[model samples]
Target: MSPYKGNRKINIPISIFVVVFAFILLVIPTSGNTEQLITLDKQKLPHKFSIAAPEIRPLVYIDKQGNIAGQFITMFEHFSEQTGIKVDIKVMPWGRAVQQAKSGNSDAIMPALYTNERAAFFAYPSEPLVIFSGSVVLQHRQDTRKIDSWHDIHDSQIVKVRSMNLGENVGRLFVNNRNELVEVVRIVDGLQMLQHKRVDYVVMDALIASSLIEELKLQDEIKVIVHPEESRLSNSYLAFSTSFAAQFDVEKIMALINQYNDPDKYIKQLEIYSH
Candidate 1:
């Protein structure tokens, strides 16, 4: 009787072990098959994509010291490091660049302002790494008074570069009277226009305007007006191709941007490249 009881106990444990082992074996193969499907999906993405940047001053495409001047290089380098993707930077005219990105000739744009219309053309990461502030600057005219708000700009004839979008958020506020906004091709021309009293104001990015003013020695003529800050017209970002959403990883791109935003690290990194 004791021998029989011991045999029964051993058989029960052996049966449980066999059942558990079989279940694990079944699960392992199923898990591996699911993983393979995921791998296959990743492999189906397009191998390469292109990107473009609007000809924004000091930010996207700028020619400084006979060199392509802008933060676009820095932003692209960061993107490449994180995604291991190659991007062809085509420094075309602003209008052409937008057309290229819109038509899917390129995979993305380096830095772009947000707009409802633009949103339809490209994909954007939920977060923006770079923040931009713009202002209307011009030659310090003799009859200047306290310029305060967008309402103040209504009557003024402003000069902005052709094919440039201020952004949907601020566009409505600044673009009430299209006649007042003169479109110029070159910043030099715009500055010259301002100096010549051809335009009452030039809506320009603060940094680009400052850099150009210093580079061109236009401080004597142009001055930054201290009006009520157009806080609404603030911030733009790096945009990606919506079509390549599967091919590119958004998290990695965001991580790269976060690294750029780190003052302690990115500044040093920029200096290394700058020098």
Candidate 2:
């Protein structure tokens, strides 16, 4: 027997494939919602991710353009461009920002100071994303009782950003009056309160406070009360919600951060924006 040339077989009609494809198109949306969505695919799609942070001036803030702009935001934006993971930044009060992470409403929080209290709720990367010095406690220039040392703070009323841990330990020890160590929601609010003599001193980073003071035109009024003996060196890390940490690889994210984060340049950008 020779080779038999055969053409007769089950002819899968192209119309069937067309019908299946049309069904898929209806079942799945190509893009309808977010600006970052590459596709609305189910099995193969990249999911949207978000982060929250306190509006700490110069480091993380809502710029004059009403857009979230700062060091950490810039770093994540670069990461998003490289990795296709959309990073949404929510700038809120420090307390609410922490709450956002704890409740898993935000995927992560960044530039957060490490605390045993916070460690209980947020998962931090092994290394810090930012290390900064020059914490300052401000007093109005007119009220000018010198505060060059911890001894100088005396019985003065001071304001601390509530839900923030930096220098709070010392405040508890030094501030004899419980009511004297007032708490505020935002740093800008604290500075403004200090401006109006609502509080005698408002504690924050010297550089950050200066920028905000200039913006509010309170530069001439509020003066930094420096105490090198009580100088604070802070380390801030990218922290994720417990569930979100489990979802992503922490080391990979940290590597991306290290690649993109530049503190010196970030400061320059802040200066540019201030001008």
Candidate 3:
């Protein structure tokens, strides 16, 4: 034992110091690498985005508690949650809403039906948010004339909401004649005119017509006429203003919308709000 101890008494303190130095070397780089990884992950997230939507009912409207609420609103909220985008909806008249979006005062307008004129100012998504069918709403009476197509009702006194771009041909038909194609301020006004026999028919979205008829308790007074031969399906979409489209990733936004735009999901949202 004495002979072995002659090899310079091993420094216990030096051994402990060496072990600690090796541990520090290993842990220091690991800690630095972990911090760098966290920073890189944070950089991968997308920036927040905001949008503007009109005050249209069923699609977009103010709830009883004065909150922006509707089927589209629910969809937009879900979109925000998925993409980390912040959507701020402003409820205003459709005309003003369009103007705001066009002037870049707002980032976007939702539920916009496609038209060549609107395309100049906004970028539309390839997939539509909802597909709406147009119908001719008329008073329920025994002597009501049958309407098979737009040509059949062309000469009749037909009323529609003003400034509504139904389509190029339809818009021309309505605006070209002021008397035969009466432009009302509201859907209710058009319905009232039909009820009073002031107008032969009121051209409106079938979904809105049904909802309005039920809400107004005019089930017995008003009826929706379907024209199978006429193509009346309109696709509504979330359109971004030209300026906003230039700055943001429009394709990415559209991709998210198309991914989650489910009819069953909308139905569930409508049912929840109905209750």
Candidate 4:
């Protein structure tokens, strides 16, 4: 013990040196290392962006051929190419797609109108995808209600597709009047009701109304009138869920959206598919 006690003092410094050397070896990535620290760093980054949208025609929908097709699809494809970020777009029922975004089960939802309620669950860019207005659809000869303003229809029977967020775009009063408001499952049903004289008018987005009229061949039966000047124009956005926002650089994505959000470009794209 006496002989080894002298060596123990020297061994203390050696042990310290060994610990420091081992730590350096563990931290410093080597060219021959398969599990390189740089590789781990790369794994921490996101590879692709996911988006969800409703089956709304001419905007985003599944065509008769069972493929996702629309202006929004083309826009996202361009975005993917511009940013080098892969995009996975899924088309589903409007209500289900919105619910999934609200619950953060999906990365993003497109063609969303901005609202304080929605802002709670999603992060919207200042740039808008499209600027549009809503219109009141009436039967050709059955309904003769004059909508000089939004309130003009307060006393008339008004129907809209269920789960449509028109109230946020128009106002609470647009959908809050129990006496006049009726919710239906589809825009086609609302138009049918108006055509059959069951409802006086149907409120819907102008672009959507145009598309549906052409699709259902109801142009002869239904007429669309834009909301009065007092009504504010609504802007649609490609909104990301809050959880997805936390994972990606939302500001960069928004910057890219602003760069490409040209009114003329979108109008041309829509016109290409318009009947």
Candidate 5:
């Protein structure tokens, strides 16, 4: 049907072309352009930042040479190397760590448990360094106070790391008897208090409790109760301060962190970190 015979012209609506162009734009991304966009995002992230980390064994702690070295520390190192974002670990007391993070003095804090108070300033990631199970520690087998269950410690003098939120079950007792619970700057100090009869129980991470007791030569003195298999367990995460989150994309950084997270590889890097 020679419809376009001898120099004939056909007119088409411009709107159809516009609609087709938009559909292409919505469905497809040019390969090189997409790579450039990703590179731009990574480039925008801060080159370096200080992460306030409390000295907790098997996770983060000051080594003999006075450098923060542990599973979490190694994780930061790996992340920095892979993402080109340097994360400096600043070892400090738990109280001071959160304080620095809140004041915008530090960009983030690591291996922290969640608390309603902390949610105000910190944005937590899904990847965690450790899962801490609460253990009721009593000084010397003779001191005589039973912690068959959490309720048993309602009246006991309990001391845990200051501002460290173990879990709701452990927290309820503290809320009920604020005076009975003493806050300490370090796990070592709490264990020391427990030994000196200054505190009746030092409730903290099971593995950390045993590790410190052995390190402090208190194995003969400190008794750890790991009963009531359902001890309050909390996963510790790398919490980013609000100021840092506002400065850059928190979720993007977190995605980078999680991308490298292989739980087995995590503990393997620290060779000795387990449970």
Candidate 6:
């Protein structure tokens, strides 16, 4: 119980405490040196939705450069600028592309024409992106058949890519009238089929058909029929992956469409791509 002995015991405990503190200091990071790591899930992962042009109509999907068209690039740029979101673009054949969206393979499908039949597999945004028109195409110099009325085309066997609802009304009419329609997997196949007398005619959009004619270098053989106004169509929102529908900025996408879809803007993009 002497003072010196008591002081020595206190000193021993102090030394042990200091040693333990030093060990901890050496092993663990200081507040200044600590770092944080963060990760995101697939849906939260940064990505831009993409859609495809049907294989039957290459021009809608393909460009002069033999890639997806300028329209898509323009669309992406506008949407990105409007929504502050980045997107990845893909152009696939129509049926396959729709299937991709339905299967959760792609985030979205593009330039989709609105039809009740497509509703079961996709999620449509609230805005209409563009209006497109459809027409019938045939050989330029052949004995071209007249389509002054639907009656003229009733008995004629028409060629179209399988699964395209060009004009739902027209389609319903054809179904009601019992018309003969041939389905082809590719637009080129349908064109070739028509050229070789396999079908009486091929139906397609004016822009797309012209693009295909120029693309295939078959200007001498193919031409589009624009009159009689058999069908008028418009595509609303890009079809979303049904599985991923809740993940995207649906309102922002609609806002994007409203902001940049001017006729002048489209023309300027087209002109730039032409060069």
RMSD of each: 13.6, 7.5, 10.1, 11.1, 13.6, 9.9
Give the alpha carbon lDDT tens digit for every residue of 11-59 in model 1: 4667888899999987777765566556535754233456676566665
Candidate 5: misplaced stretches above 4 Å? 1-44, 145-147, 172-179, 227-229, 259-275
Model 4 residue 51 CA deviation in Å = 1.7
TM-score of model 6 relative to the true fold?
0.63
Total clashes in model 1, counting residue pairs 3 or more apart in sequence or in different chains: 3
Query: Of the candidates shown, which would achieve the greatest lDDT relative to the real structure?
Result: 5
Give a tens-digit lDDT track for model 2, residues 1-275.
74656765678999999999999988876554434354323323235578888877767888779998876776778877765667788888777888899999998887788889889988888767776564667778888475555555656677876645656545553545643677787787888788788878887665676678777887677666655644456677888899877776666666656776754342321121111
Residue 131 lDDT in model 3? Answer: 72
Worst 10 residues of 6 by lDDT: 266-275
TM-score of model number 4: 0.67
lDDT by residue for model 6 over 19-87, one digit each (tens)? 999999999866542421111132243335655545434324555578655665666676676554567
Clashes by residue pair, model 2: none
Q: Write the per-residue lDDT of candidate 4 for residues 1-275, one digit (tens) a residue.
A: 55564435333667888899999989976774444434423544235667778666677777779888887778768876665557798987677878888787888888788889889889997777776554444435435555554555565677876656755434544565633778876566777887787877777766677677778877666765554541355677889888888776666676665565553343321111111
lDDT of 5 by residue, 140-182 (tens): 5557665465566666688888756656555766784653878
Q: Candidate 4, which segments miss by more than 4 Å at Cα?
A: 1-46, 144-156, 168-178, 258-275
Instruction: Tell me the whole-model lDDT of each prediction, alpha carbons only.
Output: 0.59, 0.69, 0.65, 0.66, 0.70, 0.60
In model 6, what is the error at residue 256, expressed in angstroms? 2.2
In order of appearance, the predictions have TM-scores of 0.64, 0.73, 0.67, 0.67, 0.69, 0.63
Error of 4 at 109 (Å): 1.2
Error of 1 at 213 (Å): 2.0
Residue 169 local lDDT, model 1:
31
Which clashing pairs does model 4 show? none
Of the two candidates 2 and 5, the one with more favorable lDDT, higher being better, is 5
Error of 6 at 239 (Å): 1.7
Query: What TM-score does structure 2 among the candidates reach?
Result: 0.73
**Candidate topping TM-score:** 2
